[model samples]
Target: MVKYNCYKPKTEIICSGSSEDVVGQYYQDVGRSDSQGDVDITIGEALQATALTSGEKPVEWSDAAAIHEAEVRATGRKTIMPDGITAAAQSAATRNARTTRDEDKTKLGEVLSNASTKLASDKGATRGDAESVMSVEKRDDPNFTTHPAGVATSIAAAVRLNRRQRPG
Candidate 1:
């Protein structure tokens, strides 16, 4: 039999007896004792030698940390979003992501057009050829743009990003 102390700032709980007993109680303490919804808790088991003073015996089980850790383990990372947020909200946020993506591709095309015009004047290819190449590239890669000016203002950031990644 062993004793365990579970500590979260302002909440201290103790459980003694078997290792299973101590660990079970520790989970209970961190889960049910949290009053504020925003606190980040790290659950750890402490040996009796390094334990804090004895605390209340935990009777009920709290699955909060277990559930959260299960999700982190399954997903391999944490989300920026807070808990209790809906699946619908997550889906809603991406509603216009495709629209913005397409618009940015268009802007990237415009930048290609301008550079191509320069190539026609200073390099070997004509402006018409540059334009054709831009169209074909966009067909092959969805990220590229075919008519940048048409959507440049709407997705300036994407245009700038796509412009940097344009094929030579």
Candidate 2:
């Protein structure tokens, strides 16, 4: 049996008794590396990871509005506002949220790319080498996004929340 350590940090050791097992694990790790480098995680995964890492879920614009409404109601104020004003407020909030989410996604993508490059450096490859490999891999993968803004918005949003929650 061949035993090897996976490159992922904090991961358990892998043991393979056959060549096929080793190859399968290698491909799986590669796929995971690609996902991490692209900051591609599902909403559920993002939420879980964020909660684990930062102790809280990121609040979206809708959540903020809901909280505000609840607080206003708690003060014994009428919850009913003018329909046009409410609509306008909701529209603006949505637009601002979208803008912030898009920006955060971009930042997270950059962070992931940098992290991949750093990993390559740790393995004796230069930044340029890592970038070249990423370029080829992205080109080969039709579904890969260069910026990946929408693809990893949840993860990015979580990162933003963590930052905001951190004490100065």
Candidate 3:
């Protein structure tokens, strides 16, 4: 077996053991003590035996990199969400709500801008063109206002709910 201790504040150990100690347990677990000592394990045999104990398929050499990465990640005692991550999540949620509200304002602005554009496009375009593009007309007409405003207002309300309106 080989063991290494690598850390400053606390030691971390990694080790590998002989195939006999590893593989014999596999046969005994399966009620096949007869097969125990009879098996002469190569590295391949030992790995297959370990897999049997785990109820897993045999491991491939290709899995080595992923296994190493998992081990490295597990060895560290760091919190999954550090303070920076928590702060970032809070900021992201805040930014998302702000962006959503800005999008609604931009939509509102577009409606007004488009009305101005169509009204000025040609003086003879008629009231219908101005009426179609204008927010006041849309808001005034109960049918036109219902769907979009309901959705936008609900989203705005949800943003308001998510925000820390009372300064803490």
Which candidate has the highest TM-score of all?
2
Model 3 lDDT tens row, 80-160: 223222222234333444664433322222111222112101111112222222333234334544223322232223234
* All candidates: TM-score: 0.15, 0.20, 0.15
Best-to-worst lDDT order: 2, 3, 1
- Comparing candidate 1 with candidate 2, which one achieves the higher lDDT? 2
Which residue pairs clash in candidate 2? Answer: none
By the TM-score metric, which is better: model 2 or model 3?
2
Candidate 2, 23-134: lDDT as tens digits: 4333123232232243322222332332244222233333224322321222223343333222333454455556745443222222122222222112212233324333
Best lDDT among the predictions, by candidate number: 2
Relative to the unseen true structure, what is the C-alpha lDDT of residue 144 in candidate 3, on a scale of 0 to 100?
A: 47
Question: How far in Å is the alpha carbon of 41 misplaced in model 3?
Answer: 34
In the predicted model 3, the residue pairs found to clash are none
lDDT of 1 by residue, 1-168 (tens): 333333222233455566544544443332312233422211111001001211111100111122222223222234422431112223322342344454332221221222211210111122332343334434433455433322111122322333344444
Model 3 TM-score on a 0 to 1 scale = 0.15
Question: TM-score order of candidates, best first?
Answer: 2, 3, 1
Instruction: Provide the lowest-lDDT 10-residue window in model 2.
Output: 117-126
